[model samples]
Target: MESMEPGTVRPGGRTARVRTAVLQAAGDILAERGYSHLDLADIARRAGVGKTTVYRRWGTVTGLVADLLADMAEQSLPRTETGSLLGDLKANARLVQRTLADSRQGPLFKAVIAAATGEARTAEALRHFYDVRVDEWAPCVQQAIDRGEVPEGTDTHEVIRAVSAPLYYRLLAGGGRIDVAAADRAAEAAATAARAGVFLSEGRPR
Candidate 1:
C-alpha cells in the first residue's frame, strides 16, 4: 500500500519476520556504529531482506530512524511501581541510569540524540518517544498527588523529567560515571523538589 512503512507490517509468518529482521538489523547498526552510517542497502544486506523492500518501505533515512525509535519505545519495559513517591522515583531513576550506562542502549540513545539535533523529523520523533515514556511514568506522580505526598497542581510529566534530567546532563556532558549513586541522588533531588512544590507549574520543571 502507498501508506505502508517499515513499522506497519501486519502480523503473519513472513511479514512479521521481515519487520523483525529489518528492525533488528537497524537497531544493531544504530547501536554499533550510530545513525550516520545507516544505509538502506546495508540494512537490507544485514537483515537479509531486499534493498527494494527497505527502500520502498522506509523511503528515507529519517523515516527509517523514526520507525526504529518507535520500535524501541514499543519494546521498552513497562514502568515499575513502588507505592511511595520516593520509592517510585528511585526506581525510575535507577532504570534511567542503567539504560544510559548500558553498552548497547547507551550508544544507541546517544546516536539517536545526536541525529535528532540536526534533523527536524528526527527531533520530532525523539520528542514523541519521550512523550510516550513520560506519559507512561506520569501515573506515579499522579498517585503521589492522590496520596497528598506532593503539592496540588504539580506537573506530572515534569516530575518524571526531573528524575531523568540529571542523568541526561551527565550523559551529554560526560561528567561522571552515571552510577547507581548518581541515580539515587537524582531521585532524591526530584522527590525533594517535588515535595517542595517546585514543579507546581503546568508542564514546567522548576
Candidate 2:
C-alpha cells in the first residue's frame, strides 16, 4: 500500500492502509533510533509519505507516539475468558509476555519509557498505553465478580494492572527475566491478591 503523509487523508479505502504504514514506520523508528532521535521527516521518508503530511498530522514526536500507542491499543489482543480467574489471568499475562518478548515491541517500549523520563507528553502517552491495556483486561475481572469468584467491589483496573506490572518492571528496570514462569507468577500474585481482598473494600456497600 502506498503510504500517505501523516495528516494527508487519502481515498476512503486507503485510509487504513496509510495509517498502518505510518504506525509501522513510527514503531520502526522508535525501535531503531530511540525517542530523541526520532524526526517527522525521517518517519515520512521511511513511510514513503510527505514530510509536510507527517508534520501536519502529528505536529511533534510526542503526538506521533501518542497516536502510535493508540494504534497499538486498537490492535491489542482481546482478553481471554477461561473458566477460572487464574487461567484467564495467566492468558493475559502470557499475551503481555509475548508482546514484550518481541524484539521490535521491546525496543519500542524502551524508547518510549526513556522518552517519558524526560518529556511530559511522552509520559502521558506511556500512561495511555498502560491505561488501554488495563481497560482491555478489566472485563475479565468483572467476569470473575459475576461468577462470584471475587468480591463484588473489587477494583478491576487494579487487578488487571497488577498482572502486567512485574512484566513491565522487568522490561524497564532490568530487575528480572520475563518469561512464561514470570508471567505465571504475576498472574498468580494478582489472583492471590484478588482472592485476599486486596482490591476490595473493607466497609459495607455504599
Q: Which stretches of candidate 1 lie over 4 Å from their true place?
A: 1-12, 202-206
Model 2: how large is the Cα RMSD against the reference?
5.2
Candidate 2 local distance difference test against the native: 0.80
Candidate 1 lDDT tens digits, 7-69: 344466986788778877887798899898999899999999999999998999899889877
Q: Report the lDDT tens digits of candidate 2 across residue range 50-166.
A: 788788878988898888877776556677789889999999898888877777777888888888899898788778777877887889898998999988899899898888889
Q: Candidate 1: lDDT of 196?
A: 94
lDDT of each: 0.83, 0.80
For all predicted structures, in order, the TM-scores are 0.90, 0.88
Looking at model 2, residue 158 earns an lDDT score of 88
Error of 2 at 70 (Å): 0.9
How well does candidate 2 score on lDDT at residue 164?
A: 87
Best prediction by lDDT: 1
